[model samples]
Target: MTKQRSDEPEVKPFKGPAGGWGSVRSLADILPREHLGPEAYRELARQNKPDGFMCVSCAWPKPADHHPAEFCEEGAKATAWELTRLRTTPEFFAEHTLAELRGWKDYDLEQHGRLTHPMRYDPGTDKYVAVSWDEAFDEIGRELKRLDPKSVVFYSSGRTSLEASYMYGLMARMFGNQNLPDSSNMCHESTSVGLKAALGVPVGTTQLKDFKETDAIFFFGQNVGSNAPRMLHDLRDCRKRGVEIVTFNPLKERGLERFTDPQNPVEMATLKETAISTQYHQLRAGSDIAAIIGICKFLIDWDDLAKADDDLPVLDHDFIAQHTKGFDEFAAAIRKTEWADIERETGLAREELEASARIYAKAKAVMAIYGMGITQHVKGVESVRMIVNLLLLRGNVGKPGAGPTPVRGHSNVQGQRTVGITEKTELVPVEKLEAQYGFKAPREKGLDTVETCRGVIDGSVRAVVGLGGNFLRAVPETGAMEEAWPRLDVSVQIATKLNRNHLFAGRVTYLLPCLGRIEQDVQASGPQAVSTEDSTSCIHGSRGKAKPASPYLLSEPAIVAGIAKRILDDNPKVDWDGWVADYSTIRDAIEDTYPAIFKDYNKRLFTPGGVWKGNKASERIWETPSKRAEFLTPGEISATGFKDADGRYRLITLRSNDQFNTTIYGYHDRFRGIKGTRDVLLMHETDIAAAGLAEGQIVALESDAGDGVQRRRDGMIVTPYDIPRGCLGAYYPEANVLIPVEHHAEKSHVPAAKSVPVRIRP
Candidate 1:
């Protein structure tokens, strides 16, 4: 790690914090809340077609025609963020030095407003100056021409349109480097890698319609309310139909317990909230495998007992026999897992596990939903595999409302990956690219976010081109990632807002501001519409309504076009200008490249509500060699509980209600009584009592592994809660300081945020 001064502001812990329902009420006043005037947003939010742009914040599926107030809290924030009246002109850039700008907070940087022009970083003056698009593009092209393809990493964000993402993929492929690391690596990479390895495809099995028909909903390690508020309506509707909703997490998040739908007029008028979960189980961090396995074992035992009494159907034996493999070996593994070990690890008694399994068994249709909590661990891939395995036991994959659902964080993350944003997978097949583009593209796999950072640190990486994302703050090893950015020969950013990543300048760095998703895209051809894929593999056209924040600002597609034209000048075969002139051509290219998935992409996007790229094998079609979903015989599973005085307590990192990924919207966490700050830990009362710490006690948490990473975050107020006895929870980015870059999932490179081992001290 590089030795450097920690210039980041030190946020003090909140003293005498209020607790309970009152805290949520108090938050309404502190957190930034302002409704768009009816006149200003009326035309924008109309259900009638103006443009078909989806919200760029979350992956919550939206109906083709939803009412005006159909948007949820997070959706409102995301939509409002794009439609913000703020602007960051060249004058603003001229005023703030790179070093001085680096000192601004994440929220402050975002609040400074959107970047309005193409600018180049002048290290000599330490400030950015406006530059012509051609000059910036030529500079980037010169660097690309000088360096080996492997020396450059092309990073992307989820907010990019499908056409832009596809073109960007083509650009990197043309450059002969597959180093296309995007935002996916940080959040749902495990789901994509793990689920695909286990089931031959990577996507959620359930469609939005499934929510209405589901008999039971089991959310594992996901907080739907804060993350995807519209999901509350589905859960609330399910509850009305007497459907059982259960939650399993390390912390008793308010989102999973109860939610007041702000969109509902009657509900909001009465200030009434609906209960989301009937039974909330607090599984200790890192204990998910044990708990899930224990439930499977209990179901097996219950089946045997039911068979003796002529009351069978304890499990879906027929589905297990017909559509899955290795169940018997997996059953044997579950039986061998000791009850005491299960309790010691999962912090759940056999009865509790049995109770949950019995309810699961009784339900006709069930959907097991999860998020980063299940994917951000060393065993994250295995954890996802296990969830699918459990679902397969009951033949949950194909049936409506009964399957594996990994709730994606960003709105276009799944879509971006599906289109092109990948370092490992090829966007266009090599043979196809060779034939169509007339270039012998590189077949070697590219570097993801982790590999890119490592490549830069080791001096292999020379340049980075970002397409709308904060790369440094988003990835782990903050120090390493930050240091490596400045060493790059050229850093190009095509973005909408000013972020921390812009401050990490290079020898020849350029910031090219692009149009937001809500802004209409006008090009050389005409006004264009871009497409994006959702979590369930649904592709739809997104058209922007608002005018560009600046006349000079370009849409993502045009920005990529400008760079590609300058770089691919000598290559007569490539038609960069034509692709950017009309987005439909890019869609045609996508169709030509990925025929199986994007077949007739141009025609289908215009179809009512777009088309769904069927996850055929993900529906339990079983594309594996055995032609069945294989149930792995997992090894003995146990977690190190707090009882082990050698200093081990499961630590879980979380995102705040006001924050989304590395982008901090505000400092207030209303539900937790945290205001203008983000430093605090929620611990179990028993653990606090045992540690001799009182409520509001400031404590230092040290990692048990002694990795020498900032092992301890001091001056944190220890608040007692109903969290699992052996685990603790804290907000990320701030708590990200505690996670080591190497401490990641074995298969997926995802940071082990949920299962970090630590000890708390007063």
Candidate 2:
């Protein structure tokens, strides 16, 4: 492998199609780097199989007819990263001080490998010392009891299984605190808020089979190649079947143009690829609201023309009248929107939006797909609702192959939310919990990721318990979290691997090593199988066949139960001991809580590819107050993207081809032609020339929120690319420092990481 520093970014124009030899080379380099052998190869074959562990990366659904290699390049990387032979034991921590470790890059810190034992921070020595599980849990419980329950924050990452997520949330409720927050707050809170309001549900309405039957698939800011590579297979088949694909994004991402499936013998042998997008529209960053409104306006104008000429109506009048409400007002808002505003905001000509609308109107079924690009903005919630409005105009929802689907990040982030890991108490079944657990569940709303960090900064939050995530690095204003983390009285992290999150230890911190998904988790009854819900609402079992990574490692469920057992000692109704002994007890408890969703839990969950627990929106059963799909109008139809002023440009923080959310797989982004570096900026040639800057010029970035706060990052090399004018792109988590914590969505409070206004200084 080439030894390259992340600071020295090298750019080469990648002429290869997505996947093909590029993806093959990626796996080849990473397999040996992570020290994988024949045993790991066998485990890779079992991924996404009937009785095997789900891919530990994206939440993309598995097909009913599972292929031998169902995982993607990123999935293989995640599995290899997890199953690495190298270990980070107490001895590793004793050698490195927190001050020295903090100076290392995220990729360098992660390369230390999986954690092996439970350890606590030694403040005097500024190092971590190994501790027993009993001592760690006891001290955590004592700290919780000492502080006000509301002051402690309970957080989890999407890597947690559904069984563990449910228990984790319930344990916090049992402790008389409802301060539950997970990774969803940073990524898809907009989707949850927007979908619940527009469709009366907070989950994806489309299934895996929908891809086969859809007439058109509309891509919005979702980079499928880097994020969910396995999805390219279904898309390749869709292209062969003549399904029209329209894409609207800031960059001409390699994933949206063409893809050559590596697993397909015909494609690999023939050196051929499938064309993905029929119509590609490049728009300004955070301008989806204007683009969507323009499309709606065009459709509404076509409908009016049809009415006047006594011709066929363009809109789906029958579906609208029968299934939807507020059509007249929604039409009024669209009609009042001007073409000039849309043109200026979206950075597209009038013909581009009209062409997109014409294709949408002609298609019988359309699936609206999006990712964090649309969600991590100030108007993220409204932007999602606007897309739903577009789908409703043509009745592209509640059917087999159409609906709004947020390509959720993380393996079980959606499942975690489904099983009560939320700050909102209303989402949790308080009545059912009160009866089952024999405790009065708290109803007061708690702080989310944004508020939790503020609480820490203000000295209100006293304790934090994390189940498998680098929370300190994932949130916005990362510098604020890094400084505030130590202010907390106690902190606990249950994790499989060592990362940068542990370096910034609190006064009393515990890093409890847990079993990875690829390892066998045996209980008192027998071997245990944990379950997770995918992006499509399919629930299935994932059991590990390999030996445990370390003898000291505990399962996530065991760690949660251990902490609860220490804190809620007098709770008679809650059987912490039995649940820990047998995972079936936990499954039974989850079934009791949501009987309709998880009926015949054990038998159905073990089914191949899992059973689909359809959302209410798919069945056209509105759970909203009016019992109808509401077409509520957005408060503003104005520009959503920031207008370039005083030389300030919009910065779009994105993931590299080799990285997952906040987890660096490597320093190479193959799709973008970036090698061995992440600290590089992607800009348009026009913008670079307009700013009088040359390619390869080193520069620093400063946030331009006008709050008089100095937030900046030094040493960013500019590289001109195909991104839209007045917009620049950079890698996430690394650029998160430039964004203030308070800059979040108006409704969902998700950090506006995708579109932070910034100025570049050479």
Best by lDDT: 2
What overall lDDT, based on C-alpha atoms, would model 2 receive against the true structure? Answer: 0.87
Best candidate according to TM-score: 2
lDDT of 2 by residue, 1-762 (tens): 233366556798899899898888889988898887798999999898887889889999876798779888999999998898877888988898989989888887777788899999999999999988889988988877888989999999998998899899998888888888889999999999999988899987999889988999999989999999888888888999999999999988888899998888999989898999999999988898888898889999999999999999999999999889899998998889888878887899999999999989999999999998788888999888888999998898899889987999999999998889999988989899999978888888988999998898899999989998898888888777788888889888888877788888887899999998888999999999999999888987898888787899999999999998887757788888798889888889999999988898987777886888878899888787778888968666532334568698889998988888888988888888888688788899988988889998889999998778778888888898889888899998899999888888889989998889999987
Those runs of model 1 whose alpha carbons end farther than 4 Å from true positions after fitting are: 1-40, 43-51, 308-311, 426-428, 606-608, 636-645, 692-705, 708-715, 759-762
Worst 10 residues of 1 by lDDT: 1-10
Clashes of each: 1, 0
Where is model 2 more than 4 Å wrong at Cα?
Answer: 1-4, 638-643
Write one digit per residue (lDDT tens) for candidate 1, span 332-377. Answer: 7887888888887777777888888878888888899999888887
Candidate 1 positional error at 164, Å: 1.0
Candidates in order, TM-scores: namely 0.92, 0.98
What 10-residue stretch in candidate 2 is worst by lDDT? Answer: 635-644
